[model samples]
Target chain A: MLAPLLAVLGACSQSDESITEQTKSAVTQTTTVTADGPPRLEDGSVNLGPPPGSMGFWTANNGRLVNDPNNYEAARREMNSRVNIEDAPLQPWTLALTNYRQDTFIASEPYTRCKPAGGPRQIMSPYGFEIVQMPEMERVYILTVSNAMSYRTIYMDGREHPAEILRPTYLGHSIGHWEGDTLVIDTVGFSERSWTNRDGLPTTDKLHLTERLTRSSLNDMDYTFTIDDPGAYTAPWTSGFGVEWNADQEVFEYMCQENNISPAAMVGEGRLSIIVP
Target chain B: MKKQYIQCRLITVTAVLAAFYAPYVLAHHPVSAKFDTTQSVTLTGRVTEVDWANPHTHIFMSVEDKSGAVKNWAIELESPIELEWGGWRPDTLAIGAVITVEGPLARNGTGQIWANSIIKEDGNSVFDLPDNILESQLGSRVEGPAPRWPDGHPRLGSEPGQSGYWSVPSQHSLVESGVSVAMDKHGILANIEDAASVAPFQDWARDLYVIRQQNFMKDDPLFLYCIPPGGPRMFQVPYGVQFLEQPIHQRVTVLMGGGNSNWRLIHLDGREQIGQVTGNDNNPLFFGRGLGRWEGDSFVVDSNGFNESFWFSNGGLPHTSQLHLIERFTRVDLNTLQYEVTIDDPGAYTREWKSAWTLLWVANKDLPDHYCQDNRP
Candidate 1:
């Protein structure tokens, strides 16, 4: 027993030495190419170009334009990790329509007249987004194409919610946890004010969504989302995909009002006349 | 045999080395180096703390830089609502608590740094668990507004004489003839579809709709039993709303009138979702659950997961757990916020529907301190 224990100890030391050596080699290799090129910026900042595109934001699929499919499962994974479209299949309906088609849909009578977007499909559309992360408060902020922004707090302290009834909203309330490297988010407290999609799919305030995001590779992530709202559907449904990281991108100030045609027409703008005939 | 042993040892060593370095390589990529990544600056300073509740929290500290110039650096933190849920008490970081802070420096040169970790002078870190604190301190400049709602907005529900007129436009299309209005400006209603329109039901939805219709025609026990109106309805009540802007921290505070009525804090910090539970069983009497973000000039809000103890709308629309709503309030003009709400609850309707209206921001007005306790109808 003593002999085997000694052998194990020797192996452990050997492993530690190897690790140290490998680290030294890595540092040496990395430093060898050091030509301190440009002076650092005053802000100590690096520009991250156009934000990495998510599969949901893809402009085309297999050389065809499409709408973002409600692939909740894939979205959950991609949101949590590095996003890459090449690794995952082009989800169904992802290329159903182009940005032009989406504009047309918004211009159509049902939507123009203030109809609900269809159920289970609205959240996945490719649009502008702002992703805000607050590590101190354990919260994440998401502003999507629909001009909806959600603030989700990650409960780092092991505390439960208080006892009482709640008011509801469109994006619902979300809480998240880190499972290994992946972040798992559970959302509920949805209001009846939102449809599942632009086509008017339905859901109740009981809507609950569980999303898992995992960075599968350096530049890509997998997102998986499961939706369960007993009041609307027969059963829970799952969907999702990959999102590619665009490191050199900043979340632009997405001002919907600057080019908003929806409100203009809804409040009786002349644009409706062009489409109505 | 000696050669074979050496080869085996090499392979073993290489594998172990790779295994040990894989995490470090993955963690220390260029992305990690971009945002003042590893260096931490700990600041020890006076409280100068401002409790600007939701969206984000702000604390300003007077720190002496390397040049010995005492500059007021602004530190942004999370809202009190989030902190409370995280077991943070009101006095956790008191007005006079000399604390240490750690965070990344700002991308813009404003002496401001995003706080990564905050420690008390007692050597106790405020948020050590969950690795919430990003770094420790080095004296750096902090900037941004200490959170405070701009004062002088009229309090909600303060108007004296004229009965308040709260109108919710009919959600049905003009083609659909039925028109229903709320019984009282403060009372509830849930308008079901015309009986002829209810179809394509898979039995359960049909039955639930029938029960809901019956509940609506009769006096809802929820209202009689003094149960609070649940989720989406809480905001629909036509009441004066007030806006509190904290420019320094880029946060907004919206105070509404109705029930005991609650306020919503919109954080302008460049932070996204942290995994905090969305719903609470307690505080159900308050605003159900609020998650808000800004998209350009509009503020979009999604709320739900309410106790079924309330009505769906003032028009008597009934709902089950499936009630999910998406609301968009776009300030089209300075005084008008185009409010659009889409209602989708399979338990209540055969198909999803939507409604559109405008919320006129009463400018130059003060929110009246209207308490629901005095008018317990």
Candidate 2:
């Protein structure tokens, strides 16, 4: 029995490795198109032209748009401070200490390990995001390309949140309303098991997030988020970003268990590994 | 205190009784209640036509009762592949061949009979009887049950590395128990030291081996035609397989993922002999004869006489008329079954090879009632 079982696993694992290699090759082939002499927008933001004859476009962070590259840190700091943290908690897990620890920062390991970064905070990562809308259901699904794919469904039915309070999940409960061309969303009830960033900033279950999504152009969309959680922050903070649409790519099913590497490492270190070989 | 204790005991008894009777009511509700299992129906009919296809073959017959009322009845038979290997064919019955069939009626209360066996007007059984059938008629010959080491338990010839038991606690996940090991890169039997000692292959059988090797992963015509590869091939497909046990009738229905379709009904009717056969065409279709019986605590089945058109494994193992399979299925516990299959076909293998695996009980869930004809794809 063990012989045949090993044979099947061996076949599937080989397929997983080939798929990963294919993804890497595809990434390398992706051409980065430059901005066609920045064009100004009505909101005072500059628009970079279409990417390499592709319909999708890109925009730099507002403060980072200046000529001096040395002030990148300052620009990033300003952008980080502007993030709305009114309802967003610092960290969801009780194990996370309020003070940041250098040892806890696992560097690039967090994203590669397929760990959930929580909801709205995950949407802020530098990676490209896509929004899939189902008109009949009045819902929108947001997909990200990090090792972990996070999805959030924004309900637009004008119904109140469950009165008894519901359990927190990674995506959280999102309710939305459309104001003219902008879609305003209120989200709460997130689980404390996620990280706020790849650096391991944590969040709590009481985290509340407000987001404004507006399709400012045919190929681009603007996103703004306000976070509020008294347990983790002193005051509310706001952050905004923009995303470009890619019509060619579609979401595929991702099963983390196939040829997982991170769990193997944990098992080697005597951690409780849930995956059975 | 005494009064309260009496009330608690009564509640416990009621709960236990409900749990025991629930499955009985569920199985019989609306459908099973419509048919009488004990009422055996014998029908004499002319073979009007035969649909020699997978899932099961249907023999369209026009029968006349004592009142001379002509009624059309559909007699379900084993696959043509099975029938052909068993020395039967679609044209064996012809258009006007008179035959008698004895079996249970369909649950739909229609004029259909699940033909147990077909008998000729001259009282000759068209199906090959185990005792009188020659090796040629039986097709491939595989080894029967054999004893194993360590407590002298019989070895189940499943592919190595399969898992799961019959009965698992409710908390266990079926996925964990249903793991199947990948075959060796050189194929399952590559490492056998005595491969030369395996059964010798015939010309057509050797051609099948080459075909299977070249087109293992390629989409075959059977899949495109939407035909459910019956029996063992269905179980070994990449998709999941589940067994639904109707304990009241001591019957088990096996469902597989291939085609998301078809099943085997294991009737524990205490009969050992193979049934009669009747067909309307000269050549049999695929998925040959199957006869099951109980050996000690295990259910042993013999299936042979299959067509070579279908691949044996998803990895493209092939077989011919010489493909004889002896499968033993034993419920290890309330939720797990130890499945052992022995492949003996001189036409395909150099020698006899065996594989063993375990099938987990479907747990508290009911097997999805999926019909292939209804599938959108």
Fnat per model, in the order shown: 0.00, 0.00
| Candidate 2 Cα misplacement greater than 4 A, ranges | A1-101, A107-111, A124-127, A247-257, A261-264, A267-270, A273-277, B1-377
Worst 10 residues of 2 chain B by lDDT: B5-14
**Against the true structure, what is model 2's DockQ?**
0.00
Judged by lDDT, which candidate is best?
A: 2
Candidate 1 lDDT at B267 equals: 42
DockQ values, each candidate: 0.01, 0.00
lDDT of 1 at A254: 18
Docking quality category of candidate 1 according to DockQ thresholds = incorrect
Q: Per candidate, chain B TM-score?
A: 0.41, 0.42
Candidate with top DockQ is: 1
Sorted into a CAPRI-style docking class, model 2 comes out as incorrect
**RMSD of each candidate?**
29.1, 27.2
B58-126, model 1: which lDDT tens digit per residue? 566556545555555566554333343345654567665666666644334455544556777687877
